[model samples]
Structures are given as structure tokens and as C-alpha cells.
Target chain A: MKLYGKFFLINLQSQMQYKVSFFLTIAGQFLASISTFLSLLFIFSRFPEIKGFTLNQVLLCFAVVQMAFSFAECFARGFDRFPSMISNGEFDRVMVRPRSAIFQIMAYKMEFARLGRFFQSLCMLIYAMIACGVFWSLSKLAVLFLMIICGSIIITGLFLVYAGLTFFTVEGLEFMNILTDGGREFGRYPFSVYGKEVLKFLTYVVPLALYQYYPLMYLLGKSDKILYGFLPPIGTLFILPCFAFWRFGLHRYKSTGS
Target chain B: MIEVSNLTKSFRVSTREAGFKNAVRALIKRKYEYIQALSGISFRIADGEMVGYIGPNGAGKSTTIKIMCGILTPDSGECEICGRIPWKERTRHVRDIGVVFGQRSQLWWDVPVIDSFELLRDIYKVEHSAYRKTLDELTQLLNLNRLLKTPTRNLSLGQRMRCEIAASLIHSPKVLFLDEPTIGLDAVSKIAVREFIKERNRNSGTTVILTTHDMQDIEALTERILLIGRGRILLDGNMRELKQRFSRHKKIAVAYAGSLSSDMLSNCDGITVREEKMGRALIVLDSNLLTVSEVIEMLSKTVDIKDISVEGVTAEEMVVELYKAYRI
Candidate 1:
């Protein structure tokens, strides 16, 4: 953790070297996210609810998924771009260090530009909270906070899975994005809206719905079952298999170049 | 101490022809061939020894280094460094070693050299006092006081290489693996790097394994040479033995005031007139067959010698001769 802090500081200092480019990227990220926000507005304007859920409820889902994604993108950007690290032989550098490869890679890069989407999501979250006025309670608030935190972990697991695939073939694997970026796109509304099959797949296979849909349902009072509120913690378990896959890939690692 | 025995590694490379039609066909039906990169190569280096690893391009120098460093695993063999198998105990084993690739920069390009060094300190978990002391020593020795504040991208190749050596040493590893550390360095910088490496080895007894195409590097630093070619260890011995085996000939250049007939020295055994000009004669003599002084005495009687110089064969020619002898 201390080394990660030092790496964070040095990477932040590196980004500061290009002040103009840094701000431009942040602005670009903000604008790119705004288009996604505008599409949500256009769809919500067409119908007051998506699958019987109000616009405010859907906005809340969108805000949580976006916040969690941006958080993962900001901190775990190294895994998201692991193929480049492999191709450029940076992973060999990580291997020579006396630390675990996963820690070194995790601390390798930090995309501060994702702060643009983070702030945008925070604003949407505030708007959704006010518009969807649920009675305040400590457990309700705890569940929402845990939902965001666990959602980031699940999303980070997806990034790790993506990075793990690079050891076999050091090329960008596009299909894995269906679970990462696609999760954020589909998580804008309740998973149930996607029908029974997509919900079951996300639940049993990827487990994106454990944190996003089931827990959010209990928080919104749509489900009286208290078990649903605690299910998000199980989503953190998804990282275990992802990490195991990473270790397996690491054993089969064939470094590029000489 | 490092011990490698019967280490072998092969890579499966996809093959295809160059034209567009062939490329399309390759996409449909790919053909692959396994290229044996290293085959049954083995050597052992005792602690605190500076050994030079020399080879032609793609002679498995880097492959051997990578396998020992735990970057690439070998197909079949054993490499134990400091009582640890590199690939099995990667984290523990790597803590005692440092590697520098001449074509690669371990320093973060956009960050100051000091930042990278500090990060390495934390990564290696060096205590504050130890880190400070090691940094101070390396900074002074490498003359990196000014370069540390500069971004790695802005430094010259020589300056960057100096810092690279420093970066790899921030942890003060027990064994240092330098792969062509002097490549592309200027004369002064090369001398500076070689001197620092010698000093570090002398002071701390850090084992140094260096690989390079530069014969001067081998001559100046390492007493032992390990030559690999076509993925096999061709020669393993100290400089003197290698010299004695391959460098059996000596060159004597004589500049005479008067014209000397080529037939005059031709009668001498084991002497060939390699070159002859208006007032100079270059003779190649096998030292085993005939002594330099004996040939000089024979030449002196034939001509009025202005100047005579005898030189032993250099390491450069010895390597070329070795390569030719092995037909690799």
C-alpha cells in the first residue's frame, strides 16, 4: 500500500508534466460521458419508466454503475490496457521487481482523466437521490455505499480477467469488453428490464446483477427480502476466480522480444 | 552463485509468404514451426565473478538471461541462483538480482529519474536510512546528481544508461545482469560505466554477468568468457585459455628505409607476408611455430629496418576465428 501511494504520486507527477493534454483528456472524457447521459435523457423522455421503474430509479442505477466504472477505470487502468504493457515488455520489468506481478501492474498506471465521468456521475446521483426521495435510513445508506464499493471490485475483476487473457495471446480481446463496458451500458437500468435470460447470465455467470440489480431492488423497497441487501458482498467473491485465472496465465507467460 | 544446466527453450513462430494472396491464405491456414532458441546450454559462475557472455545476434544470450531472470521459463533445464530456482521463487529470487536490457529503459520515461528510484526503493522495501545511503552512493558513483532531476526522455543515451544502471542497483542486488549495458555509449561514457561496474564488484562483491557484442567490454572487465552460438555453449574458459587456443598467430609490421624483396622473408617457415607497400611489410607469424624475436632476427638481416613492432592477436579476431571454426 505504501509503495502504491508512491507509485500514485509519481504517476500523478508524470501526468502533471503535460498540463494541457491532461485537461484536454479530462474535458474529452466529460464530453464523451455527456453523450451517454443525453441518450439516457432521450430514452427516459420517450417513456416515463423503463419496465415499470421510474426515470429517477433508472437514473440512480446509471449513476451507481458509472461511478463504479469510473472508479475502476481511474485506479485499475493498468489492467484495462495490459496488452500494451505486454507488447512493450513492461511486464518483464514488473517480473524483475520483488513484488507480485498483480500489485506492480495495478500500481503501474492511474487514469485521472476518469475523474470527469466520476464527477458527472456524482451530479446525476445527487439529482436522482432528490428526485426519487426514499425515506432515509442507516441500513439503506449503508447498502448504497456498499453497492458502489463492491460494484467497483466486480468491475476491477473484469479488468483482471481481461488482463489475464493477454498472457495467452497478447492482443486486445474485444469480447471481454462485453462484460466490462457492456456491464456499465446495460447496468443503466435494472437487469430485469433486459429479460429473464440476460438477468440469469449476469447473476450466475458474471454476477454483475448481484451488486447492481438485486441489492438496488432491496434498497428501493421493491424487495422486502433482507437477503438481497447482503448479496452485494458476494459479488466481491468474483475477484477470487479472476485472480486465480491471472495466476494461471502468469505461469504460461511468454515474454515478448528478447 | 549461479548454476545453469541443460537449459533449453523453443518458440513456435507462425510462417507465411509476403504477398497479399499468401497473407490471405495464411489467415485461412496458418503454418507454424518451432525455433529452438536455446538447446542444452550450461555454465556455472561462482560468487563475485565478472563473466562476459558474448554471442552473435540471436545466439540465445538474451534468452539465457531472460530464463535466469525469471522472465521466460525454459523448456527443460535447471537454473539456480543463490540457492533459489528463478521461475519457482521469482519474487524471492529477483530480490537478489538486477537486470538491464540495452534496448529497454526501466525508468519511467516522463518522470524524473529520482522519482523512479524512489518508487523502486519503496517497491524493494528498503529502509529509509538504507535507501538514502545507497542512493547517495549510486548517485555519486554514476555521476547522476544532475541527471536525476531530469526526465528520462530528455537525457542523452549515455546519461540515461548511467541512470538505468543506477535504477537497477537501487536495491543493491547481489547479482547484476547487464545485457549490452554499453551499447550506443560514447567512449568516455563507456569507460565510466565499465569503471563503476568494476568498482561496485570490487567493493561489494556483487556478481556481474554481462553480455555484449563489444569485445572491448570483455577485455576491460571480465576475466572469463562464455561464448554461445546457435543456442549452444561453444566455449567456456578464462581469457588467457581462449586467447591461447584461438589466437596462435602474431603480426609484425616492419618499415624499412630500403626496398625489401618479398622473396627475402618468404623462405622463413610459418611466416606469410600479409601486406607489402613501398617501405612497409606486414607479416603474419604463428607464434607456436616461430617466435616473434626469431622472425624479427631473420627480417633484420634482410633489410635496413626503420621501425619494427610486434602485436598479439586481439579479442576481436579471436571471436571471428571462433565463429568461423564453429561455422555458426
Candidate 2:
């Protein structure tokens, strides 16, 4: 944790060296997400509800997925950039370090600019918390927190899978964007709105709905079962196989030229 | 100590012809050619020995270093460093070694050099006092005081390289691997880097394995040379002995007051007149067969010898000769 702090501060200092570019990137990230937010608003303006859920209820789902995604993007950017790191031989530097390769790569890069998206999602989450008609309770609040936390873990696990694949082929696999970026885009509405088949696919294959949909059902009072509220923690288990794949790929790593 | 025995690694490289049609075909069905990077190579280095690992391009010099540094796992072989198998105990093995790849930069480009050093210090888990002591020593030895405050992107290549060496040493690792450390430095920077490396090895007893195409680096820093070619150890011997072996023929440039006939020296058993002009001649002679005095006496007999100088074969020429001899 202390080493992570030092890495964080150093990365901040490095980014701050180009003040204008730093601010511009943050602003660019903010405006880009705002367009997505506006698109959601345009859909709601055309229809008051998506699949019998109010705009505020759908907003809650969007905010949770957005916040979790941006959070993962902020911290796990290194894995997202793993292909370039391998191609440019930075992964060799990571291997020589005394720390764990995962830890070193996490510290290698941090996308603080993604905080713009994070802040926007925080605002939407707060608005949904007040207007989405959920009763105020400690357990309900805990489920909301779990949704974001485990949602980020699931997304970060996907990023790990993406990074691990780079060890086999030293290029970013474009199809992986379907699970990572596509999950967030498709997640703007609750998984149930996508129909039974898509919901089953997301639940069984990727488990994006384990955090975003089932626990969300408990949060919105659609289900009173405690198990639904706790499903997100089970979703965190997705990281295990993803991490195993990463380790397997690491063993097969063939470093680029010196 | 480092021990490598029967190490072998091969890579499967996908090949395609350079055309849109071939590229599309490769996308559908690719053909791969296997390259044997290291083929049953082995060597051992005891504690505190600075050895030069030299080879022609793509002869597995970097492959050996990468394995030693715990970066790549050999397909089949045994490699143990500091009593631990590098790939098996990677994290633990890496704690005792430092590697510098000259073509890459490890320092954070946008941060001051000291920040990178501090981050490295933290990464290595060095005590504050120990880190301070090592940093002070490195700053003084590499003259990094002025450059420490500058961002790595802003510093000159030489200055950045100096800081790079210092950063790697901040933890005082037991072994240091330098792969082409002086690839594109000016003369002064090269000398400075070489001097610092020698001083560090002498003072700390750190084992140094250096890989470079620059024979000057080999000549200046290392006593033992491990020459690899075609993914095999071609020669392993003392630097001086190899130089002496290649230095049997001595070059002598002669300046005289009058013209000399090239046939005069060409007719001799051990001398070959390389060049002859109106008043000067260049001669190559086998030093074992004829002494310098004998050649000078013979030259003096034919022409008024004004001045003469004897030169041995340089390390560069010796390496080229070795490469040619090995047919690499």
C-alpha cells in the first residue's frame, strides 16, 4: 500500500508536468461521457420508462455501471495498455522488479483523468439514490456500495483477461472490447430489459448481471431475498479464473527484443 | 554465483510475404517458422567476476541476459543464479539483480530522476538510511547531483544513462546485467559509464555480466570474455590471452629518406609489404618469426630510415578476426 501511494504520487507528478494536456484530457473524458449521458436522457425523453422501469431507476443502473467502469479504467489502465507495454519492452522492466508483476503493472500507470467520468457518475448515482424510490436503509446502502465495488472487480478481471491474452499474441485483441466496453454500454439499462437470453448469457458466461442486475433487484425492492443482495460478492469470484489465466500467460511470456 | 547448463529456447515466428493478398491469406492461415534462439548453451560465473558476453546480432546474447534476469523461461535447461533457479523463483531472484537494457528507458520520463530512484528504492524495500547511503554514493560517483532534479525526458541521453545506472544500483543488487550500455554515447560519456561500472564492481564485489557490440567496453571493463555466436559459446577465455593470440602479426609503418622497392621486404619469409611509396612503406610481419630490430635493420640496409612505428592489432580487429574465424 505504501509503495502504491508512492507510485500514485509519482504518476501524478509526471502527469502534472504537462498541465494543459492533463486538464484537456480530463475535460475531454468528461465531455465524452456527457454525450453518453445525454443520449440516455434523449431515450428517456422519448419514453418515460425502459421496460416498465422509471427513468430514475434506469439512471441508477447506468450510474452504477459507469462508476464501476471508470473506477476500473482509472486503476487498471496498465492492463488495458499491456499490449503496447509488451511491444515497447516495458514488460521486461516490470519482470526485473522485486515486486509482483501485477502490482508493478498496476503501479506502472494510473489514469487519473478518468476521475472526470467517475465524478459525473457519482452525481447521477446521488440523484438516483434520492429519486429512484428506494427506501433509505443501511442494508440497502450496503448493497449499493457492493454493487459498485464488485462491479469494478468484475470489470478489472476482464481487463486482466485482456492483458493475459497479450502474452500469447503481442497485440490487443479487439474482440475483448465486447465484454469490457460493451458490458458498460449495454448495461445502461438493467439486464432484464435486454430479454431473458441476454440476461442468462450475461449471468452465466460473464456474470456482469450478478452485480448489476440481481443485487439491483434487491436494491429497488423488486426482491426482498438477502441472497440477491449478496450475489455481487459471488461475482467477485470471476477474478479467480481471470487471474489464473494471467499467471498461465505470464509463464508463456516471450519478451520482445532487447 | 550464476550457473547455466544446456539452456535452449526457440521461438515460433509467423511469416508472411509483403502484399495485401498475402496479408489477407496470413490472417486466414498463418505459417510460422521456428527460430532456435539458444541451442544448448552453458557457462558459469563465480562471485565478483566481471565478464563480457559478446556475440553478433541475434546470436542469443540478449536471450542469455534475459534468462539470467528472470525475464524469460528457457524451453529446456537449467539456470540458477545466487543459488536459486531464476524462472522458478523469479521474484526472489530478481531482488538480487539489476538489469539495464540500453535501448529502453526504465526511468519515468516525466518525473525527476530522484523520484524514479525513490520509487525504485521503495520497490526494492530498501531501508531509508541504506537507500540514502547508496544514493549518495551513486550520485557522487556518477556525478548525478545536477541531473537528479531534472526530468528524464529533459536530460541528455548521456545524463539519463548515468542516472539509469545509479537507479539500478540504489538497492545495491548483487548482480548487474548491462546489455549494450554504451550503444550511442559520446566518448566522454562512454568512459564515464565504464569508469563507474569498474569502480562499483571493485568497491562492492558485484558480479557484472555485460553484453555489448562495443569492444572498447569489453577492453575497458571486463577481464574475462564469453564470446557467443550462432547461439553457442564459441570462446570463453581471458581478454588478454585472446588479444595476444590475435596479435601475432605486428604492423610496422616505416618512413625513409629515399624510395624503397616493395620486392625487398616481400621476398622475406615473415614480412609482407602492405604498401610502398616513394619514401614510406607499411609492413606486416609475424612477430614470432622476426623481431622488430631485425626488420628495422633490414629496412635500414635498403633505405635511410627516418622513423618507424610498431602497432598491434586492435580489439575491434581482433573481434572481427574472431568472428570471421568462427564463420558466424
Which candidate leads in lDDT? 2
State the displacement of the C-alpha of residue A100, model 1, in Å, after optimal TM-score superposition.
Answer: 1.1
Residue A188 Cα positional deviation in candidate 2, in Å, after optimal superposition: 0.8
Best by TM-score: 2
Q: What tens-digit string does per-residue lDDT give for candidate 2 at A141-245? A: 999999999999999999999999998886549999999999999999999998999999999989999999999888998888889989999999999999999
Cα displacement (angstroms), candidate 1, residue B164, comes to 1.6
For model 1, residues B225-265, the per-residue Cα lDDT tens digits are 99899999998889988888766798899999776778867
Candidate 1 chain B lowest-lDDT run of ten: B259-268
For the record, the alpha-carbon RMSD of candidate 1 to the native fold, in angstroms, is 2.0
Which clashing pairs does model 1 show? Answer: none
Candidate 2's docking class is high
lDDT of 2 by residue, B119-181 (tens): 898999999999989988888999988999898999998998998888888888999999889
Per residue, candidate 1 scores C-alpha lDDT tens digits across A167-192 of 88764499998899899988888999
